[model samples]
Target: MSLSLFIKYIHLFALGLLGCYLLRYYGDLNPVLASVLCGLLFSFLPFQSFIKSTKGQGAIYAGTFAAMSSSRVLNSINDFVLVCILGGLILTLFEGRFEGLGGRKGMIAFLAVAAFYMYRSVL
Candidate 1:
């Protein structure tokens, strides 16, 4: 990925992680509420131009999905960050496809989480 794209991915990844952590700690550990509240908070940020972009929004979804794995799987911050980055990479990889489909973001997040689980288990 280009430097700009890579930077954007990381930005979005952080936003996602922030949302997840915020909700996990402050929002009663509800993934649905986490995503919703984070989405709303992000939408109102000053960086609306970037936040409104396709990749931008998708990155947040991917981040939340990745780190939302059960405690049984993601036992550490390392694991959480890895899965989140994996989701970000995957999101950036397929950022342009499936525009007409719903739940594609969740699907991508599932793939990232499953991949990380298999990686942690198989290795």
Candidate 2:
């Protein structure tokens, strides 16, 4: 497979595993719910939207790591930083204007990162 396709598959697999973890621990739902939720969260909605709308596939690819991080597969500041950086990358890439980022966009990003970390902590 091409490098890009390989990476995409890896991301999908990671997303699937994340779904499994979340359903088992966080969602406390059935296995079928895992597939449905992961499909909606990772494949159909946010990540896929990024792939369609921008050249920031790298950011999407990177941001998907947040799911893996949420799975508690790794525990480190580095993983947190990775999610933060990639979240910023996505915001910058899509918005195409970085000025006054300490305003609305920055707050949104902060909230998103905070929410992810909070959810992971609870799981």
lDDT (tens digit, per residue) of candidate 2 on 1-123: 244644443343344444545665577766445545654555445545535443334333334334433345335545454445435544444444545443443343344456657666787
Best by lDDT: 1
Looking at model 1, residue 70 earns an lDDT score of 70
lDDT of 1 by residue, 8-65 (tens): 7766876786677668766676777777777777767778677788678878766776
TM-score of 1: 0.84
- Model 2 earns a TM-score of 0.35
Q: After superposition, how far is residue 106 of candidate 2 from its true place, in Å?
A: 40
How many angstroms is residue 63 displaced in model 2 relative to the true structure, after the best TM-score fit?
17
Q: What clash count does candidate 1 reach?
A: 0
